[model samples]
Target: MNIVAVTSCPTGIAHTYMAAEALEQAARDAGHALSVETQGAAGAEPLDPAVIAAADAVIFAADVEVRDRERFAGKPTVTAPVKRAIQDAAGLVAEAVRAAEERSDTAPAPSGETAPLDTAPAPATKVTEGAGLGARLRQWLMTGVSYMIPFVAAGGILIALAFMLGGAEVAAKVNGGTFQGRTYEEITDLSALVEQAGYAGVLFKIGAIAFSMLVPILSGFIAYAMADRPGIAPGVVGGLLADAIGAGFLGGLVTGLAAGALVMAISRVKVPRALAGIMPVVVIPLVSCLVIGALVIIVIGQPIASAQQAMTDWLDGLKGANALLLGALLGLMMAFDMGGPVNKVAYTFGLAGLAAGNLTVMAAVMAAGMTPPIALALATVLRPKLFTPAERKAGEAAWLLGASFITEGAIPFAAADPLRVIPSLMAGSAVTGALSMQFAATSRAPHGGIWVIGLIGKPGLYVVALLAGIAVSAACVIAAKHVGRAVPAAASGAAAAEAPAPSERAATVA
Candidate 1:
């Protein structure tokens, strides 16, 4: 039998290539012709078109979704966990050949005929498009947000380091920052300011430069999501217009959507064959950006600037009940889905506030985000009988994950029993958020959890708030599980985090 295969693993490290090699050796020993594609960190060379067209059957050994899976649609396919190929390659290969016989009996394309692309069934790995416009809009915006975060994290941390080293008064010595009304000399020139503020000035200026790119990066990526690479130039130009008019991040959001829509519309129009070659490079970018600039400057700029100012003012004045309510809301959002869309919304709100120099919101959001995992870890230890051995093992790693502010570390437990776990997490997070706000805790850095404690205002009180929330969440988990028949966690929940990264995804395996 002629066969084709694809192999992939989550990290795309050793396992992907290992599986491919195992399958290839098995096929050679069985005296069958086989070609394998390994989608790994090393790289993937797609199977030749002729090879795919001639294949009698296919096998997919993947721990993650296969890219462009429609290529194998209607073929007799055997799918299994990636490790299965490494462990039982001969058995899996036999299954594929047997499955091909059944496939021929059912949907007999002529012996040499290949299925047409349009007629192929949808791939199993596809996320449904039936989710509607609202979901797609959120996804596009999130693409931008995902790209924007690195800029914020880097800039915010550097600024915190500047303040830490320069005694929190370095801004007063910079070029025309809000003067703190003290008897001190300040300089406007970059060269002079560096000399006056020393290394603190250097760090602050570098951070400020990075911060300046935040709006443009967000806008560009949003447009990219909507219209692919053709949308980037116009989106960036729109962001520049937004910054020029003091419209801030809100203006950038508006400009990004507009740029993307415009590009999409332009792309659909027919153009002369000679000109079509340059349309993306010359026509679309030039035309779309001009429209985006006009829309920002003549239409939407001032209203967004006013709105941005109002939001900044409101955040600056947040205290008492108002602060507590906002904090609790943010907390609920963070714990709602752990690292899903709802969690991202709350994080984005905090980032917006951080950019506007409202540090308190950032503090509350981070505190709430850290609560769920620690709470789960504590619950596993304090009440081991309520959890399976696998969950208890996940709990051990959750300690470092939680301290590092990786809320997704708690996802394994949440997925097992969301009914009991989610509410407990939300309740604890709300408490932490409220307390952090009430204590006027502030974070100069966007992330780092307890490691960045020195950059947080009222760090002592912040720790107290974290501890309080952890206690509440853990107790709730233990109580909730004890009162109910504990559901056995899916063995697959163990895939939650073999490696930790600040911005990595928590994608589900099929």
Candidate 2:
């Protein structure tokens, strides 16, 4: 069979490409022609229309809805989550082949006159895969988070830039005396802002606008992950209500889940073929939104707002020892896996706090995350003999990686000697985290590591904490190396040949 397929994951980074490769390999093994589009962070080129038209079947392996889904309309299609494709690409290929054959057997005979390219968008046959409830929920939330990150980076960096340009006085004016938030009604003309605080005011306004979308995007995409495109409207509208009512990110989480659940339930109610086309586009979104709006307004709003406020109050009231302990815990998480799931958890928590006007969490998270790569790089420099030639090369790159807040640069070293390197990195990161909190070195930016020093509240203190962590981690690495096996430089040819490349498997943290 000839198949046209699209693969997309939440972040559209590693997994999208992985799934595409898996499907291609599966198709080739099965003696089928396959055209696959990978929709990832950098975006994707459209597959040829002719190729799509000629395909016997379509495969949608995506967490988010397939863009331009109508292009595959009326095709015999098989749909599964992107991870499913990675896990069982051969099964998906076989299923697509079956779907194509089934359609060929059932579809009406070809006629002289052709139907329009854009016709009723039939729901693709969804394939179920095994995963626990907890795993599925985590995957769904990650879907939301992955989509939400670009907004965080762009908005947070722009706000940081605004502060750099306008300084304290401009921040005071634009923030309406506090960072908790300022009303949209307070927005003034760009010309007027330029007259007042120049470019800084304009940037702050723009950044603020971008930051405002954090909740809706998170909610919408979470729903999108569960129910694809049909869930977006309800989820986004519910999120807007959540934001307006002071329910914040917590509320966004609830609404996203609720909207997704509602859409799924609605989709399962068997409608006539005549109504099926309209169901996804109109009835599902309309009904879900109306119910969700009512639910938020009448049942959940006040309680969630109160909880959000209480959490904010607790964060605001955190004192020396309490703050230090929190920072240390977060730091440990940051360095625990060097930009793996644990690191992302810490990073995501920091982002949540940044949105809540609690800047210290962001500061502590970044400082701790920066520790591992910097420390590893420093160790490689101080004891070059302890590392292989390739390790040394990786270490050289780690300096810039660590500085830029890409923690996975340290992964190659960790993979080689996890027992020694990981603990030391964690210890040093904890120290940095505690100190950052103690010094009250705050940052509005979610990332940009050392480069964003100018925007940090206590830039000097932050640098001092970072350096201190680097020193401690480096010392620990040197001490632990004494117990490890001989360096890769001493390895036999086959052993050395089996080693993985430093850049190949490293994860990117936003």
Candidate 3:
């Protein structure tokens, strides 16, 4: 059989090429002729157009956008984040191949014998168009989360190192502009000060800044990935503006969509062909950035920042009942969206609150944010074949990432079965969030898993909260899946009860 594939990742870095190699190797191993396309920093290139023309199936292993889906219009295809292609390439390809066979069987016949676009059925059954908004959004967030993982891990380590080495110095660059005020200057000899000044410190600080910028970057790139060149500039600028203005997830989401739309609009406008090459890189970015930046700053930024501050204060001031409610919301946001805007809001607030001496709130936020992935990792461990062999392997790999507070490690499972997986993650995350609040665990570091214990107060309680949350999230996922399955079975039974059996004559005629 002939197969075609496209591989892409946001950074056009390691994962992109890795997935491409995996797909190519898998196709060869399966004795299938294959054509692969890569959409990278350079541009799109089909390995062989003729192979695509003759291919029986297509695989899009991409985190970014594929330029034109129209070319593969009728072919059976499987789409997934690029990392899946690398980590589980052979299995993913096998699944795609099997899906292709099913598609060929179920798909409508070609319009005519000359129909080059085979018009095969999709691999999975189509549901209501609106069925999985949460799942898809979660998938997008997971993509961002995965990409952001390295930034957080690296930043956290640098922060830890700063504390260990610098040890309580009130240096000038250590605290940056924030230390200008005596309020911040008096912040005990924690030596979180040395992080910004040391040789490697700048790199670590940059990583921290990058981590903070991650969601907006992902949101923008994701829009770009989906919408193509038209989407890149607007998405990125809008994301940055959203961050500057304090527009949370909702705002970032709006900006992401708007950026893509803006791109689409520009693409429709007629422009000189000679200028086309510069449009995406130069013209588009300039115009789109101006428009998006204005909209965010003027329309959305101030209100969001105000509201976020207000919410942060309320949570900080919480004594008993109020604390519980705030904790629930923080936990929900942390796990609900992974590292999306909602997650960022809670996390950012936590970090900011710590600077303001509201350590308890920060503790809750970190605890919740770290729980989902770790819990999901554990779930995969316990269930074994509940996940594919490749997924199980990825799950094991996630342990290190999860320990380092990299929530992106959970993306693989979430992408594979979003509906069943996320809620499980959220349940654990919420429990962790709530437990942290109850214990009043406090942390100074913005990012770190359990390793932040040294930088935090009440380390034992923090650990307890972390473990509790993980347990709850894991249990929730397993139970939720079982419960969800029953609902589907009930629906099927009800459908069966309402339908009449076919008569022998009718059956024969049919």
Question: How much lDDT does each candidate structure score?
Answer: 0.69, 0.69, 0.59
In candidate 3, where is summed lDDT lowest over 10 consecutive residues?
A: 120-129
Better of 1 and 3 by lDDT: 1
TM-score of each prediction:
0.46, 0.46, 0.55
Per residue, candidate 3 scores C-alpha lDDT tens digits across 254-286 of: 676677667658766778989977876788778
Ranking by lDDT: 1, 2, 3
Quote model 3's TM-score.
Answer: 0.55
lDDT per residue for candidate 1 within 1-510, as digits (tens), equals 898989999689888998899999998988888899999898899999889889888788776657666676556666666888899898878877775665565446432112211111111111111123433354355456545555655565566566567744565555433322343455657777667878987877777777677678768867866676678899989987876776555567778889988997998788998998898789998999989999988887666556545554554455334888889878887898764445666777787677678899999999999999899989988877666554676677677657757575675566445678889999999999989988989987565576667789999999999999999999998888765332221121321112112122212232
Residue range 1-510, candidate 2, lDDT tens digits: 799899887678888999999999999999999999998987798999999989888888876657777676557567666877898999989888876775565433132111111110111112111122432454355456545545555555566567566653455565444333532223355556776667887877787677678778878867765666677798999988876775556567788889988998998798998998798678998899999888888888666556545544454455334888988877887887664445655677787788777899899999998888889889989987776444566677677667766575665566445578889998999999989988989997666576667668989899998998889999999888766333322121111212212121111100
- Find the candidate with the highest TM-score and give its number: 3
Stretches > 4 Å off in candidate 1: 1-150, 175-188, 242-254, 273-278, 297-299, 306-433, 437-459, 466-510
- lDDT of model 1 at position 77: 66
